[model samples]
Target chain A: MPRKAADEIVIALAGQPNCGKSTLFNAVAGFKVDVGNFAGTSVAFAETRVTFHGRKIRLIDLPGTYSISSHDLAEKVARDFLLSGEVDALINVVDASMLSRSLEFSVQLTEMRVPMVMCLNMMDEAQRKGMEIDTSRLEELLGIPVRTAVAVVGTGIDEVFRQAIRVAGGVVPAVEPRYDNDIEQALSRLLAVYPQALKDALPLSERFVALRLLEKDEDFERKVGASSPDFLARASEERHRLAEREGRAETLALGSHRHGLVLDLYEKVVRHRRGNVLGTREKVDRFIIHPIGGAITVVGSLLITFFLAFFLGNAIAGLVDVPFGALRASIQAMPKGMGPAVLIGLFEGVVAGAGIVLPYLVPLLVLLAIFEDTGLLPRIAFMVDGILHRVGLHGSSVVPLILGFGCNVPSIMATRTLENPRDRFVTMMVAPFVTCSARSVVIIALAGKYLGVLATVALYLFGGLMSMAVSYSLTRSKKRKSLGVIMEVPPLRQPYPRIVVRKVWLRLREFVLVAWPVLIVSSLALSLLSYAGADATINGLLSPLTTSVLQLPAAVGIPLFLGLFRKELTLIMLGAALGTDAIGNVLSNGQILVLVVFTMLYVPCVATLAAQWREGGFKTAAASALLNLGVSIAVAGAVARFVGAA
Target chain B: MEGETAAIHALHSDGATRKRIQSLGLFEGRRICVVARAPFSGPLLVEDVATGARVMIARDLAENIEMESRAPEGR
Candidate 1:
């Protein structure tokens, strides 16, 4: 099996987690790549073309991994790419300050004999810490070019391209790391038994596989077995013999041996400063983390965020309502015809869902981006670490919980950051129960029409308490051990206006695109059902649950059911069902409070249900929806009973 | 105790250990100052002389760390 000639250069950008690899990729690529599903899998990959020396270069930003060992999905993706032999060169991004750990991966790549160059990123931070590395010596030891970079500040970018082009052009030879004599002898013995074809196809040197086999890496065994099962078994026996002679696991010995060499090389080349310096970040942290000061700041920030979201949403809703009102009035003027009613109803649903709700979500997402960009979210996470621990989650879960207030889909998606499976699952399950902006519209409209603004706020508080109680009870019953929050709190910088706006617009655009179609279809369906006298039949069935148990009119259940498709449609449906004036006369203040509470705790919108299934699987999704329905019914029933008695 | 500060000792136990220290700017021949310590056994505020940046680290994490104070030698 002969290999295909490299028609296009495939370069892999590899690094350890949180080492500024993504930042560097974003800086270099800058929206030039098509971001979508990677080939056949749902996993996303960004593909872009850059004209380097007049030749198009294809760059693949591989998932960041700690090592090539297949312990996780990220590691498997990275290791498979490296072993594929399809890539022409590798751009190994290393954090200068965290060189030693970065170097361990670099050593593994060097053993693969891949045409590679090292990008020592974060030079600014490294220099600030008063550390200097002798790049020349490092290059000599690793047998590859080493380029220093401060990626965020856009330094050494040209050098990165220059080295990449050189490697791609075959102007530079792959560098091989010098291993210990014992390992070298064993590798040569192992290679002697390998078939010529197998030897040529593998990207890494025979020695690297021999070392991995000694370590008993399961993935390595499977890979070797694919080529020669007999050879792999023989190699395992040899590894056992070597481990007994060495009086240790051959893997641990190999790691120590590599560390020893990296240390020897670093000793001669690295220099550092003596004492620490006082910086501005420390001064700011004092005020932000102060028990009293932190509380004030947190409250103030949250209030401002909510106020901006509410005011902006109200303004946008006012602007959108003018056309909708006119369109409805025109349809009513036409001789009460079925066609006019159906067209007008569909228009109302789209207007309510997309025009009114999505615009409001934009400003809120923008405010969230400001908080995330300025690094205030992590500080807030720190402040709530104590409370979060009590609920079987770490402080990091706060981000997703906060995001739930904006939209539950992304909030559930954000749960991927949590390491523990149980924590992620529980957070995703409960996030939709946190009344989002869509629910706010229903609460406000009902409160304004029947109750008042004060009652609306009180109902919101009640909803929040219910969400917390459910979260606590579920977590406690599960008996999940609280994991400590180990997060990197990035330095606070002024938010980038362009990036913030782009992120906000992107999210808002998704809301409009997905929500508008569903809303319009739901509105049309409801209108037809009403015209056909189906509402009466549905209300007759709903009377037991709404009128008897919840002590509300059967008419209210139609809108509540429609609310599951689009939340703002609940208000619109209620408006059409009860009319503006009749709603006030029909439902008393106590009944209105019951309605608002039930609506807040009821099943999430259809889009959110789809997101739930995607994030939490079918069982969790079905269970979450059923739980919401059960809780809404019980709470509404109890509240209605108490209010009727009072 | 004063004379012992000037004595040459094996400051770093091993290479892997030394690399971890170096990456965090707490390498051999580097100076570190404890700017502030939290009440009880909370987080510590420390400054790195090389970069002049102060960082807050948990006290428990700090306990596993070893540092050489270069302040004994007059700057």
Candidate 2:
């Protein structure tokens, strides 16, 4: 195969929070990226190469932001990138049904004068809603090539690429909307002071920069730098004069003017009607949002998820046990030696770590991805918004809460969406209590086998209730003002099978990469400890806590240490410590419940700790771990006493 | 003879109006009604459309907002 030359074309896929921007990027780039309905899911830029017409085009998928006004970090990144004029073309992906709001962004992009293409995505949904937008009129009004696309189904994808390539190749004309006369006059004055190189490099004309300066966009001023401060000062003064003459601030005036144009464009091209579908959607929303119905749905979903995890975990555990049983039998049949003991230990460790825990974790993550992709999660957030507000956290924090079900590392990372630092910290500190899949595995394996299904459910509920209580306490300690919840609920769409499968696979791969090495090393270390006399001493020391409080054998201590690296390893090591069938027999139901509860609320895994360190420094990570440890111990002690008494 | 004039507390309409309102939390059962219309046909400040809450939005955007009238004069 001939090597294709890299035709570097920076194409930005921009849209609202859940309008399938990431999904489209995955379809085009053939890579797995986070896709969720709630805001701030994509914080960083993801780049990939796609071959279009035998040319490699580098596509940059930026975080979904509401506007280019630099109100937030995601918006700042999008605005700066567009202003930098480094990109060959901008591909604005709009949700077709929500054209009115989506078009506002396209119009804003047009003012920047970047060679752009409009991809009208979700065409199927638009048609279903009886929306008929005149594409040609829209194209003419925006002065950009428009391509209809159903990105999930891969429709009109080729045309999207073609238009993008054409725009990059300078075949498409840029649309520079005319501003008011006063603004134009100020822009001309500012333009004369700009260096020729700077003028040539910027995507928009000096007029745009002047307008931004008038609006006091810090980023715009920074981009212009010290060289044009005098000019910027004059521009700012002129803008004030213009605003004074118009009897309004320049920024508000400019906003209304742009909004005026947006309204005109929507009036001209977009049409809608009273429809039954809208009514149906509303009725459904009522059911989903009602206090009783919503709570029931949430609990039901969680119950189903647990059952699925249990079923899958048991199957994988059964398969793993067969090989282990065979190996143990064969080893006993062989001559007595250290080799047989070591082999048995190694085989037992691998099966316990990989086979039992991974299957459960992987499926739960898949179900989570599906729930998120299908757009039902945000409704759940809306339902809980009232309670979350009372707790001093915004409803948007629900994304992190839902993600906590899959893994706390990503859940902690999702806290970046919270605008208030205090809120973010509180959310991060409490998020690990959401019963992550790793803990779920431990609960299912231990509580289910020994205690019962009801006990396992109770354990999970305890973890959740504990997390909320901690969050509530943390928020109260700060005595902060209530943060408002502003979230976009993307219309529920069926999750694309391809995207969901790829996301699940990618998440599972990440887990294996991060946890597998740690699991193997921990197993080997534990085996060595057992081989020496150290295991006996360690067990003896842990016996007081395990027996008096937890009421479990001393051997369970080794697994608790392993839980720090990987939660499921605790169950595996526990299984190995107390044989497969005899596990429930040896450890009483109360002991098992305590063990499960402790493991669930225990310190986060090593991967999560590293993520914490990266997200919030070393001090924060240490604080989080130590806090969790104290809570877990206290909770376990209490649970142990209660269960023992019962 | 006319019995009495009820103070309008909700504004309801359909089509593009409903969509504009729906997006802004001005939907059925949402408390809002047009409080005042601007002289220059600018934005309107409406009491809640769904919850009878209050918000101010551009009239151009407001035209798309839909609301229903409160029960006439307390039935």
Candidate 3:
């Protein structure tokens, strides 16, 4: 076979959440990616190259969205890429079971003036639900090539892409939405104001821009208004003129009119059975969401995932200690001070990287993958939505919060799926306070050993409560975020190994690619700081707080300082500094409690700091670190003074 | 109106919220099956029968919005 050029034709897979676009992409690309019943599981858009109809094409799977409206991230990602116009064609995936809602977006795509092949996906589910869609009638109505598939089962998938390729090869005219004469006249009047050269530079078709202008989309105002503020003023006038003719808000009038056309199209091609065929799924939902059973099920799952990951991580981590410790001893015994420091620092990074971190991180990520793949997590998110809303988070934000227990970096990555930046910021800010697995280990080693297991659980519960309280306080600002939610409640299904493995792989890949480098480098860097004769100065600076205020030995100061790079080091360094294996011999119960509080609450681990910086930017990340410092000192001091050590 | 269907007369929300609600298939004149109303003026668990997609609306918004009974049982 002859080699194809490297200029692969870019084709996009677009659809609403849970439409199985990922599954179809997985099937065609001969690769696996996350598949989940709920929304936002595929947090980022990714591309894979495949040969379709003897031509190589790059298939990009985008985050799910209902429409091209840029109110949310998913919409922004999809529409931004589409309007870039680099994509040769779009595989517009419509969930056959939810034809009316899905088609609402399909109409918007038609106006984009791009070649598109409509993938009427989930035909098996639609048939199972006693719904019927006439594909020929739909194709005729929308004037686009249509293909049907149950993508999860890999049925009719090849035909879908084949049609897509043919359509992309210039087989059909762009389907433009036809609105009322008055609106069209108003739109033309608005368009006449823009010079042809300027209009050509607009991201979307004149019709789409006109519709958005009528709707008064903020993004359009910002982009177009930059060069031509005069256009915006004229467009507003035209909208009101059209509204006066219709006797309603022009945006609403336009929406009602366009939706009427969609309903007309829907009526022509689709029919529904009188009875709901979702018997089994609904029955199971009733149990999982039953007020009492729901709480138990969610709570039980949390316990199982946390404890399983915790014990398993500890057990495997135990195996790494011998090898890592041996390596550490060999390095330390090799030479004099600086030599030992450099070698030990790098070795410590390695020990922390693979030995300490990965064991705990792996099990937690795998469990989270399973939770999302099975669709159980979103429902838990739904149940907590009411409470979490008090803190300016969506129900979907709960996914990141729960995963924070396992680790914070991946949880921070999970916030990408949240539509609103405010939600993402607030969630990211509060997530570190969720007390991660490493913190849990710290609490167990310190509080459980000294204060009792009850105290350990109490500290975890207290951390959770403080996070929520702080989050609620954060939402008290005057930013005016709407707390309303419109999240999907997907049926829980058994996770396919292929899909779940893909999710876990992508997550761990992120761990390796982004988080690990920072973890290792920061570990080495902090060690180099200690080697450069700064430990005494750092210990001296922290002495007042560690020795006097929170009532701990000056030795504890180094661990407190080092905990920022990797939190588990609070325990490891405390032992090293004291030169003893038995921690109980060095501190009182209340003193131990204060030390635990200090480590647990102060500055998030360096890996988490890196994640925060990457996601929330430097200002917010720095603000988070400073805030943690303040809160840790205040809370730890209060506890130490009130409890009074033996 | 507990078990009956009702048309969304107006969303009583701003431009973006209204448009988003429409994307969920709940536009003006669209029918919704009211599954259950939570106690203490909480969220309303409602379903769009046509799409078989359900949503929980905050009680505050649900109250301000006006709707007419679409089905004979609630009509």
Question: Considering every candidate listed, which one attains the maximal lDDT?
Answer: 3
Question: What is candidate 1's lDDT per residue for A369-445, written digit by digit as tens?
Answer: 78765667656655655555555554457767776776777677667656678887778767878878778666655
lDDT of 3 by residue, A357-452 (tens): 677767877787788778787667656666777666555577788778767876788888665678888888888888886777677656755676
Give model 1's docking category: incorrect
lDDT of 2 by residue, A1-646 (tens): 1232445666777776666788788888775576555456777788787778876787888888756776577787887776665678888888887676666677777767777888999898887767778999888878899989998888898898888888784644445665656666666777777666556545466666766777666677776655555666776777677778767545544554554566678788877654545556546645654557767777777777988888777787777777767766776577745676576567666766567767678778788888887767766665555565566564557778888888898888888877777777777787778888888887887787777878777777777778778778777767556444444556666777877788787887776776766676666666667767588787787887776767777889888877887787887778666645468778777777788888888899888888888888898888899889889888899988798789
- Ranking of models by DockQ: 3, 1, 2
Worst 10 residues of 1 chain A by lDDT: A34-43
Best by TM-score: 2
Looking at model 2, residue A58 earns an lDDT score of 74
Query: Interface root-mean-square deviation for each candidate?
Result: 6.0, 13.1, 2.8
What clash pairs does model 3 have?
none
CAPRI quality of model 2: incorrect
For every prediction, compared with the true complex, DockQ reads: 0.10, 0.05, 0.47
lDDT of 1 at A170: 55
**Clash count per candidate:** 8, 17, 0
Candidate with more favorable, higher lDDT: 2 or 3: 3
Q: All candidates' TM-scores?
A: 0.76, 0.84, 0.82
